[model samples]
Target: MDEINSVKIEFLSRSRNESFARTAVACFAAQLDPTLDELGDIKTAVSEAVTNCIVHAYPDSLGRISVKARLFGDSSLEIAVRDWGRGIEDIGAARAPMFTTGGDERSGMGFSIMESFMDKLRVRSKPGRGTTVTMTRRIASRADAR
Candidate 1:
């Protein structure tokens, strides 16, 4: 991949950091000058990923959550949200809509929403280890608007 730029951030897995993670990703993505809709999509997807780490990962105690983002020469952006916490036992079930081990009121749409908003989504997890969610999207170039 032709990497135009890349950034990596590590922060505490706290509920309050969700917004920080989202906004930071959005700001980094702004280098592409994506459309408003595209920016919204990126923000929403980042929020879901970060919230997952805060809620599901390290539920008993705080841990580190890492976000790595890269902008490619093709104007495609790739973001990876990683957590060193209790990993998912079942990747298939976790990705299903409304399937949440997080209990009721969660809506369980985190993975589904992330998949829908991003062009590509990949999830890797191992029980007793951690999970890393990678998502990629191609920015809508301003030239395309012409």
Candidate 2:
């Protein structure tokens, strides 16, 4: 897809930053003129991706997380959340519904939720390096909705 606009942000992998990341992405996506439901889906997917970085990627200590968002000419938005901490050993298992390494406190539905809400989802990681989750959603133009 041809890129229309893009933004990248880096922040500490703290629980508090999850909301910041979510809102930032939502704001960047505003130019697409998304509906409330579309905005909510983007925010939720961002929250899950950032939360996973804070809770799972760096369980022992704080780490760096990066989020990059891009807009395409087709009105599609792509968001990538990355963490520079411990990476997942099994990407397949992580994406499975109800599979969680977060113990009892987590429901392990983050990936599944992201997949359901976005048009495309991709997860990449190296066991000792880090993990990156990229998701895209297409915003229906106002005319198309009518």
Candidate 3:
């Protein structure tokens, strides 16, 4: 495998940026020869993460979100979504399936969906600072592997 290639993009915390985030990851993963399933999984995970940032991150103030994608030598892709808003107080509870904060129409499944679709998921948050979610997925090489 070759060295990991990466792409980074930053955007405002707006609903319109969700499509941009998904497309960015899809375009980058295409270079790695990811399968259709792999691409779909990446797109879903990216959408969930980006949506969470737009909805939860900065309820009162405006901020920016950053997304980074890195294609590993093993054909696995790692994506990191970050936001500088009110950080998560309890990552453990937030990660629990169907656990969401008050208000909003969210199903509280963003983190869960990300974890289920990706090979690995990591969350880092600091109250009053920000939160960062990192997700990784391995691309299948052959039809039998699918």
* Number of clashing pairs per prediction, in order: 0, 0, 0
lDDT of 3 by residue, 1-146 (tens): 56579889999988888998998889999987777888888999999998888888887666899999988788888899999999999999999988998465889888889999998999999998999999988887676466
Candidate 2 — which residues are off by over 4 angstroms? none
Return the clash pairs for model 2, or none: none
Worst 10 residues of 1 by lDDT: 98-107
TM-score of 1: 0.97
Q: Rank the candidates by lDDT, best first.
A: 2, 1, 3
Which stretches of candidate 3 lie above 4 Å from their native place?
Answer: 102-104, 143-146
TM-score of each: 0.97, 0.98, 0.92
lDDT of each: 0.94, 0.95, 0.89
What ranges in model 1 sit over 4 Å off? none
User: What are the candidates' C-alpha RMSDs?
Assistant: 0.8, 0.6, 1.8
